[model samples]
Target: MTTDPRTLIWSKSSYSGNGGSCVEWAPAQTTTGIVPVRDSKNPDGPVLSVPTRSFAEFIAGVKSGAFFAA
Candidate 1:
Protein backbone atom coordinates (compact mmCIF):
# COMPACT_ATOMS: atom_id res chain seq x y z
CA MET A 1 0.00 0.00 0.00
CA THR A 2 1.40 3.39 -0.93
CA THR A 3 1.18 6.47 1.25
CA ASP A 4 -0.08 8.25 -1.84
CA PRO A 5 -3.22 6.28 -2.53
CA ARG A 6 -5.33 5.46 -5.53
CA THR A 7 -8.75 7.01 -5.77
CA LEU A 8 -11.71 5.17 -4.32
CA ILE A 9 -15.34 6.21 -4.30
CA TRP A 10 -16.85 3.98 -1.68
CA SER A 11 -20.54 3.42 -1.34
CA LYS A 12 -22.02 1.81 1.74
CA SER A 13 -23.87 -1.43 1.41
CA SER A 14 -27.64 -1.38 1.76
CA TYR A 15 -27.48 -3.88 4.61
CA SER A 16 -25.65 -1.34 6.72
CA GLY A 17 -27.42 -0.19 9.85
CA ASN A 18 -27.28 2.96 11.94
CA GLY A 19 -25.68 1.02 14.78
CA GLY A 20 -22.55 1.11 12.59
CA SER A 21 -22.75 -2.08 10.63
CA CYS A 22 -21.20 -0.41 7.64
CA VAL A 23 -19.28 -1.84 4.70
CA GLU A 24 -18.22 0.16 1.68
CA TRP A 25 -17.08 -0.83 -1.81
CA ALA A 26 -15.79 1.07 -4.80
CA PRO A 27 -17.80 0.24 -7.88
CA ALA A 28 -15.36 2.15 -10.08
CA GLN A 29 -12.40 0.15 -8.85
CA THR A 30 -14.24 -3.09 -9.56
CA THR A 31 -14.64 -2.06 -13.17
CA THR A 32 -10.88 -2.36 -13.44
CA GLY A 33 -11.16 -6.00 -12.32
CA ILE A 34 -10.37 -5.38 -8.65
CA VAL A 35 -12.76 -4.71 -5.81
CA PRO A 36 -11.71 -2.47 -2.94
CA VAL A 37 -13.44 -2.89 0.39
CA ARG A 38 -12.86 -1.02 3.61
CA ASP A 39 -14.51 0.01 6.83
CA SER A 40 -16.62 3.13 6.42
CA LYS A 41 -15.31 4.54 9.70
CA ASN A 42 -11.66 3.83 8.85
CA PRO A 43 -11.17 5.28 5.39
CA ASP A 44 -7.42 5.61 5.90
CA GLY A 45 -6.95 2.03 7.05
CA PRO A 46 -6.07 -1.06 5.08
CA VAL A 47 -8.14 -2.01 2.08
CA LEU A 48 -8.99 -5.51 0.94
CA SER A 49 -8.78 -6.05 -2.81
CA VAL A 50 -10.66 -8.94 -4.35
CA PRO A 51 -11.19 -10.18 -7.86
CA THR A 52 -14.52 -9.18 -9.34
CA ARG A 53 -15.70 -12.79 -9.52
CA SER A 54 -14.87 -13.47 -5.89
CA PHE A 55 -16.56 -10.25 -4.88
CA ALA A 56 -19.76 -11.35 -6.58
CA GLU A 57 -19.63 -14.65 -4.75
CA PHE A 58 -19.07 -12.94 -1.43
CA ILE A 59 -22.04 -10.67 -2.04
CA ALA A 60 -24.23 -13.61 -2.95
CA GLY A 61 -23.28 -15.33 0.27
CA VAL A 62 -24.09 -12.24 2.25
CA LYS A 63 -27.52 -11.93 0.68
CA SER A 64 -28.16 -15.63 1.32
CA GLY A 65 -27.08 -15.30 4.97
CA ALA A 66 -24.38 -17.94 4.62
CA PHE A 67 -22.10 -16.11 7.03
CA PHE A 68 -24.57 -16.39 9.89
CA ALA A 69 -24.64 -19.87 11.33
CA ALA A 70 -27.90 -21.27 12.60
Candidate 2:
Protein backbone atom coordinates (compact mmCIF):
# COMPACT_ATOMS: atom_id res chain seq x y z
CA MET A 1 0.00 0.00 0.00
CA THR A 2 1.19 3.52 -0.79
CA THR A 3 1.09 6.10 1.96
CA ASP A 4 1.01 9.85 1.57
CA PRO A 5 4.01 11.57 3.11
CA ARG A 6 1.97 14.62 4.04
CA THR A 7 -0.47 12.48 5.99
CA LEU A 8 2.23 10.83 8.12
CA ILE A 9 3.45 12.37 11.35
CA TRP A 10 7.16 13.10 11.49
CA SER A 11 9.40 13.63 14.52
CA LYS A 12 13.06 14.11 15.35
CA SER A 13 15.17 12.87 18.23
CA SER A 14 15.32 14.84 21.46
CA TYR A 15 19.08 14.77 21.11
CA SER A 16 18.67 16.84 17.97
CA GLY A 17 19.11 19.75 20.41
CA ASN A 18 19.22 23.26 18.96
CA GLY A 19 20.63 22.31 15.60
CA GLY A 20 18.37 22.54 12.57
CA SER A 21 20.36 19.72 10.92
CA CYS A 22 18.11 17.00 12.20
CA VAL A 23 16.10 14.48 10.20
CA GLU A 24 12.54 13.43 10.89
CA TRP A 25 10.95 9.98 10.64
CA ALA A 26 7.39 8.71 10.62
CA PRO A 27 6.84 6.06 13.27
CA ALA A 28 3.46 5.37 11.74
CA GLN A 29 5.20 4.04 8.67
CA THR A 30 6.63 1.18 10.71
CA THR A 31 3.29 -0.52 10.47
CA THR A 32 4.18 -1.34 6.88
CA GLY A 33 7.80 -2.23 7.72
CA ILE A 34 8.97 0.92 5.97
CA VAL A 35 10.59 3.87 7.69
CA PRO A 36 10.06 7.23 6.06
CA VAL A 37 12.83 9.71 6.64
CA ARG A 38 13.13 13.32 5.56
CA ASP A 39 15.15 16.41 6.35
CA SER A 40 13.53 18.54 8.96
CA LYS A 41 14.71 21.69 7.22
CA ASN A 42 13.07 20.67 3.97
CA PRO A 43 9.68 19.22 4.68
CA ASP A 44 8.72 19.64 1.04
CA GLY A 45 11.82 17.88 -0.18
CA PRO A 46 12.20 14.25 -1.16
CA VAL A 47 11.44 11.48 1.32
CA LEU A 48 13.50 8.32 1.73
CA SER A 49 11.79 5.04 2.46
CA VAL A 50 14.10 2.53 4.13
CA PRO A 51 13.39 -1.02 5.20
CA THR A 52 12.62 -1.43 8.90
CA ARG A 53 15.62 -3.69 9.49
CA SER A 54 17.94 -1.35 7.63
CA PHE A 55 16.68 1.61 9.59
CA ALA A 56 17.27 -0.26 12.85
CA GLU A 57 20.84 -1.04 11.83
CA PHE A 58 21.38 2.59 10.90
CA ILE A 59 20.17 3.64 14.33
CA ALA A 60 22.47 1.11 15.95
CA GLY A 61 25.37 2.54 14.02
CA VAL A 62 24.49 6.02 15.15
CA LYS A 63 24.34 4.91 18.77
CA SER A 64 27.70 3.22 18.37
CA GLY A 65 29.25 6.30 16.77
CA ALA A 66 30.17 4.21 13.72
CA PHE A 67 29.67 7.22 11.50
CA PHE A 68 31.77 9.56 13.62
CA ALA A 69 35.17 10.75 12.42
CA ALA A 70 38.16 9.99 14.57
Candidate 3:
Protein backbone atom coordinates (compact mmCIF):
# COMPACT_ATOMS: atom_id res chain seq x y z
CA MET A 1 0.00 0.00 0.00
CA THR A 2 1.18 3.49 -0.88
CA THR A 3 0.61 6.39 1.51
CA ASP A 4 0.54 10.05 0.70
CA PRO A 5 3.28 12.09 2.31
CA ARG A 6 0.89 14.92 3.10
CA THR A 7 -1.49 12.56 4.88
CA LEU A 8 1.20 10.82 6.94
CA ILE A 9 1.67 11.77 10.60
CA TRP A 10 4.90 13.70 10.92
CA SER A 11 7.09 14.19 13.98
CA LYS A 12 9.97 16.37 15.12
CA SER A 13 12.79 15.48 17.49
CA SER A 14 12.22 16.25 21.13
CA TYR A 15 15.73 17.67 21.20
CA SER A 16 14.76 20.10 18.47
CA GLY A 17 14.01 22.63 21.27
CA ASN A 18 12.11 25.78 20.36
CA GLY A 19 14.26 26.55 17.37
CA GLY A 20 12.36 27.28 14.20
CA SER A 21 14.94 25.26 12.27
CA CYS A 22 13.64 21.73 12.50
CA VAL A 23 12.74 18.89 10.17
CA GLU A 24 9.72 16.67 10.42
CA TRP A 25 9.61 13.00 9.41
CA ALA A 26 6.85 10.50 8.97
CA PRO A 27 7.75 7.62 11.26
CA ALA A 28 4.79 5.60 10.10
CA GLN A 29 6.16 5.57 6.59
CA THR A 30 9.33 3.85 7.78
CA THR A 31 7.41 0.58 7.68
CA THR A 32 7.56 0.91 3.90
CA GLY A 33 11.38 1.28 4.07
CA ILE A 34 11.15 4.96 3.20
CA VAL A 35 10.69 8.02 5.35
CA PRO A 36 9.14 11.27 4.20
CA VAL A 37 10.84 14.36 5.53
CA ARG A 38 9.94 18.03 5.29
CA ASP A 39 10.93 21.30 6.87
CA SER A 40 8.77 22.24 9.80
CA LYS A 41 9.04 25.90 8.83
CA ASN A 42 7.74 25.10 5.39
CA PRO A 43 5.17 22.35 5.62
CA ASP A 44 4.00 23.08 2.10
CA GLY A 45 7.52 22.76 0.76
CA PRO A 46 8.91 19.80 -1.12
CA VAL A 47 9.19 16.45 0.60
CA LEU A 48 12.28 14.25 0.56
CA SER A 49 11.80 10.52 0.69
CA VAL A 50 14.87 8.78 2.05
CA PRO A 51 15.52 5.11 2.56
CA THR A 52 14.90 3.95 6.11
CA ARG A 53 18.47 2.73 6.61
CA SER A 54 19.89 5.96 5.25
CA PHE A 55 17.63 8.00 7.47
CA ALA A 56 18.65 5.94 10.51
CA GLU A 57 22.28 6.50 9.66
CA PHE A 58 21.66 10.22 9.38
CA ILE A 59 20.01 10.21 12.80
CA ALA A 60 22.98 8.35 14.23
CA GLY A 61 25.30 10.93 12.75
CA VAL A 62 23.27 13.71 14.29
CA LYS A 63 23.34 12.06 17.70
CA SER A 64 27.07 11.57 17.39
CA GLY A 65 27.57 15.23 16.55
CA ALA A 66 29.01 14.39 13.17
CA PHE A 67 27.41 17.54 11.75
CA PHE A 68 28.40 19.83 14.60
CA ALA A 69 30.05 23.10 13.68
CA ALA A 70 33.81 23.06 13.91
Backbone clashes for every candidate come to: 0, 0, 0
- In the order shown, what is each candidate's alpha-carbon RMSD? 2.6, 1.8, 2.1
> What does candidate 3's lDDT look like per residue over 1-70, in tens digits?
2666668898996666686568898888888999898888788888998999999999899889889755
TM-score on alpha carbons, each prediction: 0.81, 0.86, 0.84
TM-score of candidate 2 to 2 decimals:
0.86
Candidate 3 to truth, TM: 0.84
Per residue, candidate 1 scores C-alpha lDDT tens digits across 5-62 of 2475679999888867688888877667888888887878878888899999999998
Candidate scoring better on TM-score of 1 and 3 = 3
Runs of candidate 2 exceeding 4 Å displacement? none
| Model 2 lDDT, residue 28, Cα | 83
Worst 10 residues of 1 by lDDT: 1-10
> Whose lDDT is higher: candidate 2's or candidate 3's?
2
What is the lDDT, from 0 to 100, of the residue 15 in candidate 1?
Answer: 80
Worst 10 residues of 2 by lDDT: 13-22
Best candidate, lDDT-wise? Answer: 2
Overall local distance difference test of candidate 1: 0.78
Residue 56 lDDT in candidate 1: 99
